[model samples]
Target: MSAASDIAKDHKLAVFPAFHRVADRKVVIAGGGDEAAAKIRLLSETSARLVVVAKTLSPASEAAVATSGAVWIDRLFAPDDLADAALAFAASGKEAADRAVVEAARAAGVPVNAVDRPEICDFYVGALVNRAPVAVAITSTGTGPVLARHIRAKIEAMLPGETGALARIAESLRETIASVFSNGTDRRRYWERFFSGSVADALKLRGEDAARRTAKELIGTREHTGRVTLVGAGPGAEDLLTLRAQRVLQEADVIVHDQLVPDAVIAMGRRDAERVAVGKAKGAHSVTQERINEILVERATRGERVVRLKSGDPMIFSRAGEEIAALEAAGIAYDIVPGVTAALAAASSAKIPLTLRGIASSVVFATGHDRHSNVLPDWANLALSGATVAVYMGRTVAGKVATRLMAAGLPATTPVAVVENAAHADERAFTGRLDDLPELSRRSDVDGAVLIVIGEAVGEAGANAAEPLAPLGALLEAA
Candidate 1:
């Protein structure tokens, strides 16, 4: 077979679409009539310097030229007017004048558009949906102008007004993106998320500043290699999640979530995302912390978008520090997005304020056990400091916490509130004196995560608070 015959044949086009750089370049219009005005109107959207050469100006052309920043020359068209121009429009209405302008443009090597006379034109102007920095052009190569305009209208309807804003933000981050992602594949993936993912949505709904901020955050997260994000799952409630946390979940390639993280929250991630359940409960460790760290580093090293989804705030007793340290040691890019910790959710569900103006001036968060599973050192001293103390993961060490607080001068009659599965549909709350805290924490029906609150601030939540509050929808309807 001949070399040319071996190559597959491709369909040919009557006219190929091409975008020419015209910013700050000269554009000449030979007529000052309705046709020329229309072309000028389109060119006004660009940064091109317009020069209008005509013996007489119609009122419509005068108005268009005035607003379009075009320099008007009150004289007949000449070949010299096309000098240094990137484009020329011949719209004098008279065939003789239009032909002359087209001939001059061809001689000067300038592409000319002859309005309503495509046969003599060098290029046909398409119907444009002008979202600057993100334009969509529709053309039928002069064969069907009306059809191209109809297509342009459909596209205009589909795109948001803020599309240009999103495009401009992406353009601004081009340098940063180039520096962070070394390979073309990584760079392309990064831009795919920037345009079609959360950043693009943020621009349309929240405005430019929010979109730019989100774009920067996504850019800072992963690098040439894969990276990990430590996201807080927020007390087992999907709605309580921070916007940033939700965004990361949607973009994650692999989610390493805790066993306690509700399925509903995990379901918010991409449908095809890999889920690795490494949940650790009381004495049973499904995946050790060290192994979890190794998993994060390994997946990230392979250029995967890994999300270490933890229950509650990762910064507060969720062992996020160890994971962060491991990632840092391995030289992987990582970021943290905090969520609504259990203490805050528990207080909100029980209708007990963690800090009251005069009753409790300050609030403290403490895990019932230290890293070694021993009673937290000096935790009782914190309870005696006239501050509301919220204890996390304290179901097993509730008695120790209560006994030590009492021994350290905190009154035994102090109010205590315990919330299990806070903010979830099956949430439960119990309120009693400090001496009864151990019993409250050990309830057989409380199978979910537990949070214990001790101080005068919780005095108003009665024991009957165990009755789950009305759903938020019901409360809103009642209001």
Candidate 2:
């Protein structure tokens, strides 16, 4: 076999992901242009000793080196320049010079990153989401840096700003905690409690001392009190979930979720926690509510943090009332974490305002299905209420809902929007008059959850729906 073919057969090319400890180490940069200046600014944030080698530097590079206190070598790059360096960067803006530096760095056993030249690069500098001790790096194997940066921006927004401070607090208390809890399992459990409990909250709100005190108190009393938290998983999309709901999921020792709750949302819970699916579908009840209540009570009473994860806002047609009552009657402590309900998510996805000042001053949320009885809610008053009506689980009975509204003096021409799998990747919205709802729902082919919005606000949305809203990333791109 040919040398290249033999090498390819023996080993596949792949970029191994890793974090190099460059603190107090030397990093050599051979360039005098904008690319070199950019690397200098990034390396300045770290504790690395930066050395810039260029016969002449541009104004930008000179200013950056001056501000960063990087050592300047006013001479041509030499092979010995890579000696004892942790890493090397070649952004000379000249192909010949960059290639020379890369060859020298490779000879010296140093990893080199050649800007805009992936073929010669030993390492590619990807996007960074710097939360200090909680830094996240994203890369695309030198195929697409822009794509990597976009992903980084999304993660940066999701991570709490206080994460670094919380990490610092944990580091300071690590020795004390280790001493207190000699067993490794007990130490891990204590740290999990610390991260999910009032210590982290105190760090966010009341600062370091209060958080320290809270941590100390937790150590003094290594007691586990079980509680049930009713969390809303939101409308399909994981990002639509509230921060409080995410935190509670991370802290859960047991997650009890419904069929309506998406798997992506359920996966956000602590990895080691037991997951029990007590989901209820339209006609099928895999697990009955009475049985579910028993499970919650049983788990919580056993000193396990139980999470009753419901789809969308738990308060809105999610049977949260029944569960809350059950917990209360059993004297099990519980709390509710609100989430972005289907109505809100549907409206946002369809670009429809639920309530407008002149068009719809109030909004009414109601369920299409009534499990207690076949009798529906008062349609006449709701039709006359001059409020936007957002119906949950209404796809099956869209025809009947339309008929009741029209019979109650609501115009057949009133605009309606049916949003299926709101805020999800497969989300689709159909806009038409109230009379068209049944047909629209039938043609939608949506097997997932569906929400219906009917009123003047929907009519206005249909009018201006042609204009697409700008994406959140547009601001970052503009910047």
Candidate 3:
């Protein structure tokens, strides 16, 4: 499968992830303490009619209730409190009080969450990442609530802040699109383009006015207008991909990717999307550049949303220029989505800075070899420019590069850091003097893509940095 498959077929869920429709419906919270206040804050974001029942209220609980405009019943929990309620929260803190609330909710056929009492609870509350109309709920089945929130934070970073606006726009255009495209296939394709093509791009970059104008141009058009997007896969790490790159991958009708792009990154694309591996590696040319360009033109001409997935930033040495030219020649529309380049990822993995205030003022990105597979012509000058040089795909010629740099008045003890398969779980980094770069690059264990960084700045490996961030999934046991 190109994307996630049906997990229910091979595994079972401890608690199914479901959204309860509580708009204008009563949602009871049988408490008036800190625990109930938390639930009140959460439910307040929804359109549900919140009702809090308790004999007494904490200062915080009273404030929350007042802010949420909830009906505060100044009485003890009872069975009638859950009457006509869609959902209930038994968050009274006291074991007996919580149990009483749970019993009442169960008798009323309402799903209930009993704070810190999972065994008796009918449902579990998950950490929510909201991009409204589009919400992501993450849970560890009550085993880890902290972990779920951490994951939600990570997802929140990955998703664009403007996604909710885009979703609202798409929702507004549904009927118009449905009426215009009568064929089911055409309807689905149009929506896909609406989400992944020029309209989506305009929305993201130019706001609703441009997005509406772009959509208006597409409305009622019978002919399918195909386009191509050059997406940077971002140094083999799935999380490193840009938000736009992820969107295009999920919406692509066909993904034409390189061999260096890992399976994890490729799996981000639509599951049913056609995958054409037209990758080019050393001594292997299963598909030439000319033919690859032809393929992009052909697919896009047929109204397919094509994603030309490349390793690292496509604009840098990915030969995106040739493809762009081909698309232009064919009069096809195209977009370019930048990615986290390998050089930047490699420096990050090695914990080194490419540019320092006094040590190094600039950084240069250079390929290890040219089209004919020869080391760069002026490799020595780049090394002697007093700037950090980040070399891509240069492992095979590391010896030649080191020799030339040393011969051109560059120091043999120049600091060098080499990272292979950067940002991946199996990533490895090596640091040494320029004299050792040849042996380090030639190591038998180096299998994946390699990036070589050379400069005095490589020696200053973020020694003054702050403490590292915590893992995304830390232990957080919550009911």
Per-residue lDDT over 49-96 for candidate 2, one digit per residue giving the tens place of the 0 to 100 score: 999999999999999999999999999899888889999999899999
- Give lDDT for model 2: 0.84
Model 1: runs farther than 4 Å from truth? 1-164, 167-224, 281-284, 461-464, 467-479
lDDT rank, highest first?
A: 1, 3, 2
TM-scores, all candidates, are 0.56, 0.81, 0.85
lDDT of model 3 at position 136: 84
**Number of residue pairs clashing in candidate 3, backbone atoms closer than 3 angstroms, sequence gap of 3 or more or interchain:** 1
Checking candidate 1 for backbone clashes, the offending pairs are 226-303, 259-279
**Over the stretch 127-199, how does candidate 1's per-residue lDDT look in tens digits?**
9998888888888888899999999987786676887888889889999899989999889888977875668
lDDT scores in order: 0.85, 0.84, 0.85
Better of 1 and 3 by TM-score: 3
Q: How far in Å is the alpha carbon of 237 misplaced in model 3?
A: 2.3
